[model samples]
Target: MHSASIVEAYTVTIWEMLAVFVAGISAGTINTIVGSGTLITFPVLLATGLPPVTATVSNALGLVSGSISGAIGYRAELAGQRRRVLRLSLIAAVGGITGAVLLLTLPPTAFETIVPVLVALALVLVVLQPRIARAVQRRRERTGSPAHPDGGPLLLVGLLLASVYGGYFTAAQGIVYIALMGMLINDTLQRLNAVKNVLAAVVNSIAALFFVFVAELDWTAVVLIAVGSAIGGQIGATYGRRLSPSVLRILIVVVGTFAIAQLLFRRFG
Candidate 1:
């Protein structure tokens, strides 16, 4: 009987390890390409029978690790964006801290209701990405200008708001961030994506630190996910520039829609 129990335990552990590996790879790809990787990992964690809050906090921890890896993979692209990054990092940090605190203090019922709304908003933004990008491109072309004053202020505001969202739930956060970046920064798409990874990492890392001390976390799951996601991030960053923006944007829309639908079903059904 003792031997059988031990064998079962090992088998379950191996299954979970495989699940986390798959989640990490999916997350890394989504984070790099479209930004809804949390949707994949978070649900998997929940399905594993962890409490909702525990799953969320653990997911955040795992994602932070992945984001850090992704940021490092894009280090070269981060060079010129230093000033912009510095300007926004503090705001994102603060927002993240606030969001983490909210999660710790708020009731699960409230969070459940709000999540769907947030998902809906993220979907809208994802759908509008290409249109917004084209408008920004056109404006830049019309003026024969490389920079615009409106862009920076808008970006700061968007970053602060998005950081709050990301720090809290963070499903589809990348699409929103990428859309905002496309509108604000005149840099190459690859460089903008690098910025996105750094900002996301900053937000999630700050929140994860808080959760580490205040909330219950599944450390084993975090380790597996982090390792897998880090590998995925490197692969995505390497080939991200080769992808077509239009196709990527459409993919974001499709995923965002599915996320929103899932939320709605969970809420109403």
Candidate 2:
């Protein structure tokens, strides 16, 4: 290659690493505080020139550390939930393994085509989460029942399905987990959120292990994201809940809108 080509390649590598690092930071913060970190990181990876499957693989691996940090951050709330966490974790791990297999064996075009829709769907769930929580609360109050409806086997099934989605693309799995838990488990949202963190960590950790052994690896990007996410998770755990809800809502909406537009435009424009 010519000297100019070498210089250009070097510049691109630097920029890509920087972008991935920044995305990892944002993703970690948001994932810990709210959810939907994948929506932030995945598009940035694509814009930085990774192929679809490569971006997905790298993103999953990169977030593993973040998930661990977030879960650890919630350790206080997880004190009494060991059995629940362990049982649900097994289910999530199975779904994650299944999802990873699908990612490698299925057509890449299928996931690419649905990425935007999935992001939008997750954003909608996020945007409406407050209302959903309130509605559940209202029902409990009206019925004079603090006890959760009997989830029985159905709750497990819902979690299994959600884990499949989480394994395939983590985007807003945390939000879904919280929603389901709140509706079915009669627990405090904080405790449910703690549970969500552990379960998500399980899904990400298992999927990441699979990717490490079977899929293409981008060590530079993975390292960048891991460091960035670890730092971001700490920051988020320490101060994230103190942030203004309105400001966070605006950020999620703007970023989600941008992700949707970028996905659609890249496919069509």
Candidate 3:
């Protein structure tokens, strides 16, 4: 009887791990393309029976690898943007640390009411992404003057605020980053996107280090996500641009809908 139980336990664990891996792939890809991958992985982790807090921490930490992979895959687009990315990275790191501290210290009760709303908001952002992008494009065309290459204080302040939010809820942060970039700086969207990936990765990387040391972690889940995210990030960075805008919009809607459902039906679902 003992042997049978052990075998069964191992089998179950393997299946759970596989599910996490698949979730990570989807998350990494979606995140690279539209910036709300957490809506995919976070819900999966919760459904796999992890407590909300544990799953959030693990998801945050595990996705760091994916961020790095995605950023690296965008290296071609990152040329000439080194100084800009570096300047913003320190601010993101500090904000990320602050957010991690809050997560560690605050009680679960604090987030219970707010998390669903935040996730819902992220879904809405994903849905409106194309409209938002087009609006920025039109605004730039109307201005006829290139926005500052090095944005002034407004850009710095915006990045700081975005990083703090990322450290907290951490969904759709890329959308905020890109919006700020598109409006405040003169740059191609592709290059701005590459910068967004690296800066967000820095914030997450700093927060993940803290979580690894300070929190109760599930290493098994972390490793599975990391591996899957690495693969997914590369696929997204390479082929994601080739996908039609309509296809991307459909994917975001599907994932975002699932996220809303999961959050609404938390206990029973």
Candidate 4:
């Protein structure tokens, strides 16, 4: 009886690990393409029975590899942007540290109450991204003046706030980054996207490092997601652009809705 129980436990653990790995792949792919990959992985982590805070921390850490991969893939677009990247990265790092501190300092109950609301907000952002992009484009075309290459103070402030949010929850941050940079700076969407990836890497890496010392972790889950996301990052850079945006958005919404339902049930059921 003891032996059978041990075998069953190991089998279940393996299955759970596999699920996390697959979720990591999906998250990494989409994160590279457009961001918000946390929507895929965080919910899966919760389903695997991790607490909200732990899942968020682990997700941030795991996706670091993916963010780096995505940035590397966009190296061509990143050329001549070294000074810009460095400047923005400093602000992002500060914001990331602040957000990580907030996450750790807040009570677990507070995080629990806040996360569902955050997820809901992220879903709304995801849904409206297209319209937002169109508006940004229109504004860009109307402006006859040259855009500030540095994006000025307004962009610095915006990026700082966004990085704080990314450090805390990490969903849809890329959309926010792109929107801010698009309006503030004169650059093609592709180049802005490359910068977004780099900023994400900075924020996530800082937050992950903080979590390494302060947060409780599921190492197995973290490792699984890290490896899977790394692979998915390359795939996303190479082929994710070819994938339909509508399909990806739909998938994110579906999974996010399901996750919300599960969370509400868990909290109130």
The TM-score values for the models, in the order shown, are 0.85, 0.80, 0.80, 0.79
TM-score comparison, 2 vs 4, better candidate? 2
Report model 1's TM-score to 2 decimal places. Answer: 0.85
Tens-place lDDT per residue, model 2, 1-269, is 01247779888778778888999998887788667788888888878767878888899999988888888887877888888888888888998888888888877655557767766765675577677768867887998867533344656877787788788878777766765665567566566667887888889889999999998877777888898888777766666545555565556566667667866786777
RMSD of model 3, in Å? 4.0
lDDT tens digits by residue: candidate 3, 1-269: 01247779788777888889999998788777657787778877877778777887898898998889989988988999888889888888988888788887877555546555655664565466567657756887898855556676887887887787678657767766766666567666677778888987998899889888888777778888888888888887887666555675566556556655655675335
Name the TM-score of candidate 4.
0.79
**Stretches of candidate 3 above 4 Å error?**
1-4, 109-146, 243-269
- What's the lDDT for candidate 3? 0.75
Q: Which stretches of candidate 1 lie over 4 Å from their true place?
A: 1-5, 114-150
Q: Per-residue lDDT tens digits of candidate 1, residues 49-80? A: 77878888888998886788788888888886
Backbone N/Cα/C clashes per model: 0, 0, 0, 0
> Candidate 4 lDDT, tens digit per residue, 130-157?
7765675577679855456879898899
Local accuracy by lDDT, each model: 0.77, 0.76, 0.75, 0.80
- Candidate 1 residue 172 Cα shift, in angstroms, is 1.3
Lowest lDDT sum, 10 consecutive residues, model 1, at 1-10
- Which of the numbered candidates is closest to the native, going by highest lDDT? 4
